[model samples]
Target chain A: MNKLCQSIRFVAPFLLAICCIACSNDKKLPFYGQREARITKAADGTEKVDTVYQTIPPFRLLNQDSIYITQDAFKNKIYVADFFFTSCSTICPTMHRNLKTIFDAYKNNPDVMFLSHTIDFKYDKPSVLKKYGQKLGVDGPKWQFVYGTKEEIYHIAEHDYLVAVQEDQSAKDGYIHQGWLVLVDKHKRMRGAYDGTKSDQVAQLQKDIAILLKEEN
Target chain B: MRKIVLFLVMSTVIVTLIYSCQDAEQLEYQTYYSNGQTLYQTYCQNCHGEKGEGLGLLTPPLTDSLFLKNNRTVLACIIKNGATTPVTVHGKTYEEKMPAFPKLADIDIAQIIVYVTNSFGNKMGMYPYADINKDLKSCATR
Candidate 1:
């Protein structure tokens, strides 16, 4: 009985130390948010977020003015991008508000660009997006609201960006999508994705952009 | 020897308390509205404005008093199916097209609704998930 008690006493200290370490690490690495992100395999089997160089595929979209835009539109600029439709009464509003802060924060910086893509191309026509942009006071050339075919939008959202964008009749709202803000480097590779509606995460996103911009290409 | 044993037990208790405290704060909101407020800012603030007044004319003000009173059904329907046509709230007309959130569950809708209804002084009482589920079924017909 004495031996068993001593053994337990010996083990208890070690267990307590481990618990303290674990509790601290939990704060350091949360289950969701900026720190939890990991580079993983994409749908096409290519590794997502290659830090070596920007190798993302080109995307063709229409600007708010109904002008055609390719990936070349973002050449040599660090940009933040997100997917949203205009009429959404849910997360899109909060995400837009959060991005607005980041946008206003870096509005004067020439290197920073903001891209908002519309998943509902059928309704979010270029003119409509332009009007929406105007309403949000988003002066394009620094910020661009994009629209494209539904298939194209969904494809980029799922395969390229690895974000959730699904269409389902059974969904309570009749469709489903994720709320994510993707950060892309000048080379068009995703450097990070933050919760678009989080002030702190967006703040971190701003910090990361500054970091990425300073890095040598 | 007593000191060492006491230190270990104290450390274990402290660690347990810390973790339990964090888990409680992160998950235990009695109302989803309080939780949804953070979720809204995390996800909807960009286009909606930080205050939920919306991003200029791009989005409509959830704080509109008369609008909220008159368009409960429209607001609920718009949340469920999204909107393309111009939805006139008060006298001002907003025609911006927004995405549908078909994946949001009844509970999520209820929380967001309650949040909107309460946050901007547009009080309509606390909408329970059960009520939202019932309203959603009626919404499906029209």
Candidate 2:
């Protein structure tokens, strides 16, 4: 009886482990930011409660190619977005370095896209962003380096993307911002935010992107 | 008995001298290499990357032994006092401005030079930190 109990204890954990992995495989990414629930009546006269997720707002900004872009460009695609500038000497390099790995992995995929917004409005104009993108060896429309007025960028960063940004003269790089690589889904809702500096988190972002792509299907 | 004692004393002195001569230098190199790795991660790894591959053409890779060898004199200056001019490495020209590390002391620069030159497939030997004083002079004159 004791032998049977010992074997059961050993086998039970393996069973539980397999069960957890199975459950995790079917897990879905959660919607972030403020969500509202509403009651609606269907055409068949049935009342149903619906979830209205907060999404990215519409705005016009100049891309690295010096062309103005809008939400129409990302109508059918999901994108990963971050804020940085050409001359930032801090976490931006590491962040972009990690993001570039993801960019390369999904370079040919139509569903995946990457966007970077410059918080240093005074220095990183469209032309400067163009040079920076070329130097980083990332160009083309798959990955976009965008520029905009300080007010437009900062307001969207704080409210829509849930990332923080600020201009400070006392900071070492003349600006300060978070290093979140936010993942947005096809529905324009934020699904995840990963710290761009951490390789492990970026790896998770890669896996989550795959999972999100599958969920879309 | 006196002769045997003298022989033993002479052998001990010779062995101690040989060990100190060879082993001390090896120990010093090892110390510098390891310490420089820590310093590299803290200061240089961000732009140059973990493998010294560098980011596109934005920053020049440290893996080019020829460039490192030819530019050895100005390396110390470049580290302590940033560089604005374009530098060509591995047949590519990088014009981005490298930020300065004014806070790194002479010894720190030495250890970093030792680490960078030794690692990333380049086996250039120890560049003692004190040697940076001369590099600084050449740098200032230029």
**Candidates' lDDT values, in order?**
0.74, 0.93
Error of model 1, residue B64, in angstroms: 6.9
Give a tens-digit lDDT track for model 2, residues B30-120: 9999999999999999889889989888889999999999988789999999999999999999999999999999999999999999989
Off by over 4 Å in 2: A1-25, B1-13
Q: What is residue A120's positional error in candidate 1, in angstroms?
A: 1.2
DockQ of the two-chain complex in candidate 2: 0.75
Each prediction's DockQ against the real complex: 0.32, 0.75
The digit string of per-residue lDDT tens for model 2 on A75-132 reads 8899999999889888899999999999989988999999999999998999999888
Docking class of 2: medium
The per-residue C-alpha lDDT of model 1 at residue A67 equals: 86
Off by over 4 Å in 1: A1-54, B1-52, B62-142
DockQ-based class of model 1: acceptable
Model 2 misses residue A150 by how many Å? 1.2
lDDT of 1: 0.74
